[model samples]
Target: MSETTAEKIPVTVLTGYLGAGKTTLLNRILSENHGKKYAVIVNEFGEIGIDNDLIIGADEEVFEMNNGCICCTVRGDLVRILDGLMKRKGKFDAIIVETTGLADPAPVAQTFFVDEDVQNNARLDAVVTVADAKWLSDRLKDAPEAKNQIAFADVIVLNKTDLVTPPELAEVEGRIRAINPYAKLHRTQRCQVALSDVLERGAFDLDRILELEPEFLAADEHDHDHEHCHDENCTHEHHHHDHDHHHDHDHGHGHGMKHYHDEDMQSLSLHSDKPLDPNKFMPWLQQLVATEGQKILRSKGILAFSGDDDRYVFQGVHMMLEGDHQRAWKEGEPRQSRLVFIGRELPEQTIRDGFERCIAA
Candidate 1:
């Protein structure tokens, strides 16, 4: 459905590992002149709803889930809270669920799917992940939560890119790519990406699934040489921004990076040039997730099934998978099936063999 649909309020789940700059990006989103009202539901450690007080409005609500929203227990609270929020829906334009840096985003996302009330009123707009460029590589080596955050992201804000060297930056980006090649990757400093790139993206909207390949968006980088603001202390009485400090070196850094792979967390991408048999593909996909969901972190696809004219779209978090016939194939659209999975200890050969079996003869 289109984002303009009045039926469902869009929700953006913001997640990241500790010290990944999620709050910074969130503040940028709220601080900017977007002319949109957002209802923010935040759960931070230490019960400090400091950010909530900073936001202004009758529509803006903040209920702290003191314990991290890591599992199904918190999911219940989320569902109830969302159900209550729906009653006052018309007051706010969109909702932002900001999970703690350490919290898993799966349960938060699942709320929209599992709850009938939430599903009827709110849509999962996107999972926007913020990553720390200087330390993500190290975190990936030791932290599974960090890997999951990166894997589940629809839009990834690669924040603090200026903190790392060119090689380190590329290494981090390559590491992120290894896990999720379909996310819209944007590089930023102090989480300064354009609000448009993050909020109300319609990232999860079926009609917006134009491409599966990751987009390299040079966000927060529009060449405007006018009205330079260099002093860090300047409070922007005149909203001037040069942002040119990193422009020269940042322009030429994407191609030379070495591909760094996480041994446990890897993405498996499968594509078929021919149409797939829906009857076979659907059952196999369900069975695959049923047995291996624990190992899988995220899954998404756009499919071309035999005897079907519309492009089929699907998205999954662990075992919970959802798909629908989006739109009819355009005149020159290529009929192809593309699937991606980010998970731990993936049964790659088994998956490949299984998918091959689903191709139409």
Candidate 2:
């Protein structure tokens, strides 16, 4: 069966800093009234294990890079476990991987994109981070893993809000927005957010981008320098041309938002009214991911293919990319491409110019 026809199971990664109430949240999710069955993968059978029938213990293999990031080295184990789960199909509707507090989310998220078997069998639903409302701010400043978790999240549950005053809560939220403005934020006492907010969120699905950001395809209305070219091998010339487009960096978190200056983490947007030539776009995109995958946390785009009415949508975590043609352009809808990159110190200029080179002449 083709990828389009496959039964892609949705996998949600649950992560947080140590003592951030991830286990509490897991217990709630398992004991809820929701009728769906879920296979829970955890670092271990906790002191008080969750009362789920399909609980699996992970090996907690962590890989450390030269840059001091600790990523999960459990791809092989995950592949084996998921393959086994497939044998018991109809026994569960979804799978949840609850990472160790110190685990980096990139590798976990990347597994769904990089592995052929995993990709064929499952789709990443979302990276849901359950943050300790009282300690998140400190963790953001002290822990790279904590920062990465926030940066990579599609939905953030700010747990233990009752422990902090309103002023402290606002401050913590500001800090989170500074690091990641795109993730949906929910305040809770014991990870009590509605299941609908976290499950089946289609974070990596291109067809759902518009629903998440209604102004996703609008023309660029802001004036800013869009010049980009950094690769030593990049021969593409930069040109200043006004296009019907806008790049959004502000995510509606108004004044008094703390200006966080994490040199390794930030988000950027690129937009163009010109349709892209697949011949130019594909190879360039592959090369981009191949060389810069380590630094890229999450990447997503919706493109207008040259001479085609169908919209092309793609998203990736690290080097893994998944995309396909969605529906055709609606009558009177603008045919444009919008791309968003959330990661650590992305080469904004080079990416912007490279994408410009893919424009159909």
Query: Which number leads on lDDT?
Result: 2
Q: Provide the lDDT at 250 for model 1.
A: 43
lDDT of each: 0.71, 0.74
lDDT of 1 by residue, 94-135 (tens): 888777777777777766666667777789999999999999
Q: Give lDDT tens digits, candidate 2, residues 1-361.
A: 3555747889999999999998888888888889999998888686335566689988755443334323323366777788888888789999999998988887777666556788788888899999999999899888999999998998889999999987688678757755665677788998888999889998877779766653222221212111122222221211111110111132322323334445667766676777999999999988887777777887888889898889888887776678888889899997878776778878878897898899999
What residue runs in model 1 are displaced by over 4 Å at the alpha carbon?
1-5, 45-74, 211-255
* TM-score to true structure, per model: 0.80, 0.82
User: Judged by lDDT against the true structure, how good is candidate 1?
Assistant: 0.71
Top TM-score prediction, candidate number: 2
Candidate 1 to truth, TM? 0.80
